[model samples]
Target: MRANSAAAVLLLLACSAAATAEAGGGPAVAAMFVFGDSLVDAGNNNGLVTLAKADYSPYGVDFPSGATGRFCNGGTVADHLGELLGLPLIPPYNGRFSVGSSPFCGVNYASAGSGILGDSGKLFGALFPMERQIQNFQRTVEEMRARMGESTEEFLSRSLFLICAGSNDYINNYLLPLSDKPKAYSGAAYAKLLVRRFGIQLESLYWSGGRRFLIAGLGPLGCMPSQIGAGNSSGCVDATNRLAQLFNANLRSILRRLNDSLRDARFLYWDTYSTSSDVINNFSLYGFRYPHLACCGVGRERGKFACPPLLPLECGNRSEFIFWDPFHPTDAFNAIAARRAFDGRLQRRSPMNVRELVQLPLRHQ
Candidate 1:
């Protein structure tokens, strides 16, 4: 049953890709470089010795290739965005596609459990922090320079840098009972720290010739199944949501500052919190029957642990669920979010959306 559903979705995606290509004529941007955590991770964690991994079954039941290490059941938000941009799926930095040659369409440096802060996901073991991911991108730049020479600069400048991070910093670090972060800093202070660190990371990318950035703000972390389960709350936890809101506010201010100060750089922000809240609040309108429960997992709301390798039980209709596991959204939801981020209005994607961002004239340096 799941296989049939996956095949149907695959066919639909192929048709959509073909139609999108025919309409756009070609790829919208030179490439799309992705950075962030599990939400956009395209199997980077599969090579790492980490507890935070989703390389097994029931994980990618909806994807044609099956569990390729993406957290969703099928295509991730990044994968969908790549298709919408008329580009092929962006390969993970640690994967075989990135090993022998430079992917001109860009590479994904995101890893599961990674965060803005270096020590945010220390408990997960062997994950790439934002700084390390930037270092990896630097390596890619050097590779591109060797192959394309000075042309690499223009190539990257015209490309899009899509980033979606910061959830783990709060969920796995500051809010964890065993973590020391909560002890040392208040919620507001921690958010400020994250924003400052995030700014430095973006600057590092800018220095590396990246000019177009679409940074996704943290979603309502308090509304995730894990948070609800942890707090034993029937509804979203207000305190956790407040912390996320604080970080998002700071994130927007920093991006605006960067856009104003940096030359030839356009730092567009995506309001994931508000967008996600709307979807959850009006799940029926979006075809979601289980907005707050996991499609696959065990325990209360099936949000206690990550989906196990051997399926104890799984939802028959994955497309109807917003969440695939305890911590990640389903492929259906990923597609919706990607579409919104690609062409949403000012309220969702500030200043401009990805479509507009790609259309902006590149100022040669």
Candidate 2:
């Protein structure tokens, strides 16, 4: 069967989940600690002198603030996920409010070009690598301890820790020009390297009192508009996609091992690739009139660069496109993907969904 046909058949075989309501009067978890790349970034790079930012108009035109540093045209996956969990949209760690003043829902530490390795996204100029992001989280924990006093660990144990990095490691670092990583390590070898580093980061979060982890696997980076625009192939670049798969597979194995070792911890793997690929493959099913073309952006695939403050080429119906820019999905797509990862019973979220993870009993480490 053809690829689209195969996707349609799988769709029919898939199980659909109902909307999950928040637990009782408020969010099930005490808070949501987010860390990652642009996927979950919520204005963390707003004022930073970095080339990896999206704090301009047309980016958040559909959003209330007009432009809020989210790569998408409106709310992000983190925002939707938080809403479903009965928490207010988590603010960026670098936002106006300092540590203790942040809302109980938690703070977003994700930056647009961040990756698992400290060296990743260096070309972005001043981007927050994962190590630094983790450091920021450590500081946040300290602040929480100072504010919450003796109840800090107890409260944090009941919170959800969400991470969605790795894409930029491949897109911005490994595959970029003049990079020595690809030469030094094979794709599979590099994947193992990333897994090792990512494992360490999770261990750090665990040490800092995080027990519930919603770890999002990398999506099909080769299929993204940026890659498509740069490639000679008419279809999704298979090489890049293969690299992503290798990393994701290794990541799942690492998470399983961590879960086996950590008695009180619950590490839930969120399959970003499957849900996202399915939507991209069957655009009509998701109400996307154009899956390949971005809603905003200019140049090739509307993905050559970030959508500028004034891009006259932006699509009229932002909701009808799968992507807001060449690299990031539209807000509508983010919401759909977020919901699927949150409560869907399908393979998109394995072992248990984010809802199930949140509902798990909090236990001291």
Candidate 3:
């Protein structure tokens, strides 16, 4: 999309969302910039050619307005992140919505099944690389500026950058071994690759004027519904979870080093692994009826498909449910996750918390 056209569209969407939030007696989110996979995907893949697309049935069934391409029934972590930041949830940078019904705070550039690398095979004959997502973010900002003018600064600076990705590289790409090594990079190699690629891609944002960032680490890829279903048809695979730990560990180190190297970069880590694990570890505590079993979808594990597609029972209340589908979290899960992430509990990992990381005022680019 042309930069101006994209901006105009965002301006309209933002205004619409703002109107709705005001009516609801809720405060509008300052602004938002998102990058990730299905976990935070609002609707980027809807336009792109990919089986990972969620525009179809049951994906947005739980959304406030119903069926918004959020991958799950309702909202996503990105939307909840905006709420935590004291703003309204945003939608896809590409998805269309009415003025009165939009992710008001900002737009989502996340794509389902997209990875940190374009190596997730061709989506619609084209790859949705992290670089492309970042570029889209820049375009989003440009669109906002055209509409709000000076208000754009506050929205951009105060806005949060929700970046979630890496699972695809491990799950869809290289986690599996083969004769020709077909599909994806090796697990260990993909970790380093993600770190490096993440650094480069995020640097583009930093230099382009983004300051505060909320980057999510890789979740338990092996433990995902698809992975666990690989052969076991059960929830929570030990080896896959271990690989998650490896990725998370490397991610922890990378975040620290990136902060050190960037000096002024005020970035925060959204440890989806821990946050995700917290749910699995304490499902009963969270009011989950089935922690190991997916609330929606088909098969024991490997046969799992979209939730709405299945004729199985639906949880009475999703807020207390754990896994929404085979590979994603439910809307209620995101609501709580936003609370945890904003409360500073979920993002608390090794070296220091996100608050401590962004402590140094960004003085230089």
Candidate 4:
């Protein structure tokens, strides 16, 4: 179901594209680079020690290879995106860049529980910091260019970088009672600070010749099963969701501004929020039955020590579930959402979908 080789992925995409073309399907993309938290994370957290791991038993139960450290029993949006782009599933950003080490096609910098602000925490215990992740990117680029020389840009330009973060900030750190309350960033103020930091980090890529960016905005945290489990009877957390909206709002403005200023740098905001909601709103169409309860759980989704551990009730069919855990999605749900993103059905895509962000030629106008 998931292909790890870029060439394999390309083959799948090509086959899928040909099938779609014959049967009247949608537009196909080029490449994909997944970055962010557990949402888009493939197995990037495998190298890091994060409490957000789904590598334990029952986590990857649905996965073909069993536990692979992916939050899902299987692949995430990154895997689906690679298939969508017609390339092999990219490898993690750390370690030696080898087919055995890293897939050598795309790089996944996402560490489980890593926040956009490079949050300090005990969960992941010094997981790859956002700044450090960027450094890894720069190092990778230098290394790639060293290997590929001029052909590097030709290869990279067609790729799509998918970034999904800031969830841990809202759900794990700032929300937890045991968390150290940082007065520096709270609510909208915190969102702004994150936005600013993101811009600075992104500038590093822009100046370094990276162009397109598929900036995946935060999904509605309040609507997540975890948020509901966190004690909100409305089935959705307004305050938490508000924080996500606040982040997305700033991101939209910031990206447009960046694109305007840079002229050629295409920074597109992938509306993970809206696209994710399509599933919540219409689950049956997507083959999901329980949109609320996670496939693997410690009973009815609320209470403590329920996740990544033994649960009273485990769904027989994870494919019928929308949420895999309180935070992560099932492989089926991830597949639907990712395909939607690829199809540009999120209403956030422009003349070019979020995938085309990297394809835009960048020049500081």
Candidate 5:
């Protein structure tokens, strides 16, 4: 079952005192600002003219509002995190925030198909690249300062900034034969390019007052049903998985460097790859029966396309499936992952878990 609001509140409140003490006596997590791609996107892609969207039926069949552009079958990692933080679901920065939005709980700047590089998602369509997302965040900070007259820096320092990107850089750019990226750059070169850009982005955020960061690493893209279907193989694609590992290694190094340089900042790396692969390899252990196929979609592996509308070909037992669509995890999996991030001691999330991250005493540089 999902972690409800009350459960999340209870969980966080129990540690709130400790967190307050740790942060040199400051407020508990004030807000959670999210950035990156679709894995954490709430509904940022709803109005976008991109093919990478999930604002339709069977996408949110289990959610209360239904199809809020979330790629998952229900709430996303952001939603689960919000509930854990005792805050309402984080709103997308595009639609609602475009017209005088509030950053009370937080704002989600993640857009489906976005990448670390501006041109990464260009081949797919007009998606919000990481640059644009950061621009939006700057706009948000300005707006908050103008309206609330509050100390934006202080507020942001206590907030949690979550980042989850890099998948599309490989999935849509480096791996797509039609794209010229691969021809222009080798896999190793591409990874370096992405990491350099990512560093700039994070550095920009730090300059903008962001201090608490939870950066999620790339997941096992090779194991996605789409890749599995494309290869017609019984297992995941090794080549693509290697790309993810390379990027993850660089990311860990980046975090270490950022932590060392930005003395006041706390950067925690969430190992999405390891956590997800665990579920994929041990589906039955995680109460999932189908790890290789999506509950929605149709084809040799039921992953050639997105889930159709009106529930056609949709699985009734969505909870039993690890993947909801061709390329996204179901709400069940997202919940499990989110909860683990909140308190799990697994090696996937290190230095300190999300719970410890929230309670960390504020440090000013």
Candidate 6:
């Protein structure tokens, strides 16, 4: 099918599912727990002393909340998925809502500039690594245990765990000039190391009560505007793209292993790489005019730096652009990817799509 036609069909299905969920029927899963880096961060960086914050004008101009610290112009992929699942916006872990409330829907633990490795984005300062995010979720689980008692496990088993990370491990650490990671490990070795640690992180969450998992593979990092600008090249940086491919391949193997070994748990992988590549390669088909340039930055490809605060250089036709800033996607692109992740075929989402994963019957524990 044509890319645009497929996107339209997905959009219709998403709207129909949303309507079904809203017509007095509850969301598909109990809740959605988000983890990972900036790609899906809802606003955790706002409370942190990090350079990766987006709580200002033009950042969330297209979003309903208007600059709630999302890296995108509108909603993140996680936000769109939540809406499609008939759930309200998943609150960030740092937000006030996470403290007093039971978060029946779920909380987002993703932080901008964080990665599987603790020191991956230390250059940015004060963001939650995957380990810390899991620790925070563990605390939330404990709180839920206090409130729901014996039912906590069942509630968690029914919840969806959405993890979208690992990009920073490459962009902010391994690939960076000053970082020692490149010197310590080869590209293949680095990818293996990341997947190994990620497996450990997933196991931690599993022990903490998570059952259903939706882990997003890294997108085409080398094709981001920032990479293009950094390389001063007309196209994507091939070496960086190769690194992402390696990591994604390792991640797929790890997830299959996890699903095979972990009883009652299902770990599904979402191919962000293929989805983003499709949008980039077929930009016109997806109605995107500028797939390589950011909608909100300055410099070559408008990606030399993060989108500045209180600036008017941002693109007026945001929907026509793919990248929102140097490293993130515009809301339009995010919606496409989210829809694909939710209901795309097995080629895009291995094992099963999120819609199917959410509907899987929970075996009696």
lDDT of 3: 0.65
lDDT of 1 by residue, 166-212 (tens): 99899888988888888899988998999999999999999999999
- lDDT at 207 for candidate 5? 89
Q: Local distance difference test, per candidate? A: 0.82, 0.78, 0.65, 0.66, 0.79, 0.83
Tens digit of per-residue lDDT, candidate 6, span 202-291: 999999999999999988999999999887689988889999999999999998898888888889888899999998999999999997
Better of 2 and 4 by lDDT: 2
TM-score of 6: 0.90
- Residue 143 local lDDT, model 3: 69
Q: What is the clash count for each candidate, in the order shown?
A: 0, 0, 13, 7, 4, 0
lDDT against true structure, model 6? 0.83
Model 6 residue runs over 4 Å out of place are 1-28, 98-104, 347-351, 363-365
List of clashing residue pairs for candidate 6? none
The C-alpha RMSD of each candidate to the native structure, in angstroms, is 6.9, 10.2, 4.8, 6.0, 6.2, 8.1
Candidate 4 lands at a TM-score of: 0.82
How close is every model to the real structure, measured as TM-score? 0.90, 0.89, 0.82, 0.82, 0.89, 0.90
Q: How well is each residue in 1-365 modelled by candidate 3, as lDDT tens digits?
A: 66434654556455544644553543233466678777887777777656776676666767767666677777887777666555555656665644444345566777777777676644335446677887776776676666667756534554456788777766665654542233445657656777887787877887765667777877766556666665654557777787777777777787777777884565777787887787777878887766655666787742266665445446556666567777887887887777776666544353144333333334542
- Preferred candidate (lDDT higher): 5 or 6: 6
Relative to the unseen true structure, what is the Cα RMSD of model 6? 8.1
Ten contiguous residues with the weakest lDDT in model 5: 1-10
- Stretches of candidate 2 off by over 4 Å are 1-27, 98-103, 346-351, 363-365
Model 2 per-residue lDDT at 64: 83
Give, for candidate 4, the lowest lDDT window spanning 10 residues.
1-10
